[model samples]
Target: MKIISNKGGKELKLSFRKVLGVAFIIAALICIYFAFLQQEKYIQGNAEYKKIKQTATDTPSDDSKHTQDFQVDWNTLKTQNPDIVGWIRMDPSVNYPIVQTKNNSYYLKHGFGKSYNINGCIFMHADNKSDWSDPNTIVYGHNMINGSMFGNNKLYKSKSYTEAHPYFYVYTPSGKMTYTIFDVMTVNDATVPYTIDMQTKEDFQSYLDTIKKLSTYQMNVPVTTDDHIVTLSTCTNHGRQRFLIQGVLTNIENNNRVGGGD
Candidate 1:
């Protein structure tokens, strides 16, 4: 009887050990799987970045002079993905091609190259015209942990940061336009930034004033309703809230040398 009892205890111990070992192995495999997924995402993002840079640099026109134009090889980009609408470069942080579809949901999971990607592409609000002729052109991107998309945009929450990086550029088929940073604010997802309609100049000016008051940083830049504005918005705190970096069209350089756009 004593021998049988001891044998049973030993068997139980072995079984417990086996269970722990199996659990550890499964946990390790999960870690490895997630690591591989992250690595794959990094590779895809890097490849897209390289392709865009190469296309932008391959213009047959004088490279030095063309740099000033900020001309996008739209034909090539459209060939890859017809959703390609424009490109945006925020000094020292963001340089990305913008995409637009009939709806906003598609690009949240698709790249500018039209590949499924976790990093996603910068996309304009579907409600706005793809030509960027809206009274307020609002663009959205993920606040990626890797600082790839609009992740660095969170830095503008700092007053000093906005002062250092006060402008961003938008290049459309019509022209290259410069937007001067005016307001960086955190607001509920349904606030004026997301829901306002600016049909009249007075309405826009009132909207501007409200956002300016809400801004985390006070910018001396004057914004009138007459100015075409661009709003860069990204999710913060799991989409319950948003961080908006708003800018006014400060300057524009068109192909015909006639600046500004409606």
Candidate 2:
């Protein structure tokens, strides 16, 4: 009886050890699975951080700065067109998709319909100033969330903001251009003029007058008939309002300017 009891005890102990070992293996696998999941989240967060490093033009949101080292070699990536000269940098992160394109979103890779409105870019020939390719260009961008997309709407309340960050540079495959920000305005289409005639001297003057009246800050910019104007617009007030920021092209030839956009 004693021998039989000893044998049974040994068997029971061995069974318990086997059970314990199996449980440990299962627990370890669960832990490894969770660790992998956490790594994926970390990767996504890092991508977001780098993507938005330069969303703000003036101040550093956290510790990162908004300027990018300019390289004209990237101009080869730009679609070929005289009217669609080059891309402008507002901050290194946000490259205002430069183009003379009214039909598409300035050769932008994503955003537009993918992240913004589907009707990305369309030609607008405002009356006097120039065509959609006019020296002074007025184009609208869709309102996007993350605020970094085309959240140009944020400019309306930023009178002090624009003053602090007053200029951005343009880099073309062929030449570089400089621009000084002069006006930031918010308006609803008071006159439903066609987009083609939007730049007509008469229309442009009215447009100028309207913007000046709505300007939150005083602008000392001298925009002659010769200067090129580029306006970036986006939705505001839940798409009820539009925000406009205007700048005159300095036509800086010989690459005399330092460009990273902001």
How far off is model 2, as Cα RMSD? 11.8
Looking at candidate 2, what is the lDDT of residue 16?
A: 100
Tens digit of per-residue lDDT, candidate 2, span 105-221: 442333212332232322222332322246556555555444443554475456667666667655554556667778876666432211334445776666566556777665677
Tens digit of lDDT per residue, candidate 1, span 94-146?
77889888887898888777788887899988888787767688899998877
Q: TM-scores of the models, in the given order?
A: 0.83, 0.55
In candidate 1, how many Å is residue 218 off? 2.5
The per-residue C-alpha lDDT of model 2 at residue 206 equals: 64
Candidate 1: 10-residue stretch with minimal lDDT: 57-66
What candidate 2 gets wrong by more than 4 Å, as runs, is: 1-68, 74-85, 91-93, 99-135, 152-156, 189-206, 256-262
CA deviation > 4 Å runs, candidate 1: 1-18, 56-70, 256-262
Q: Candidate 2 at residue 255, lDDT? A: 56
Quick one: best lDDT, which candidate?
A: 1
Give the alpha-carbon lDDT of every model. 0.77, 0.52
**lDDT (Cα) of model 2:** 0.52
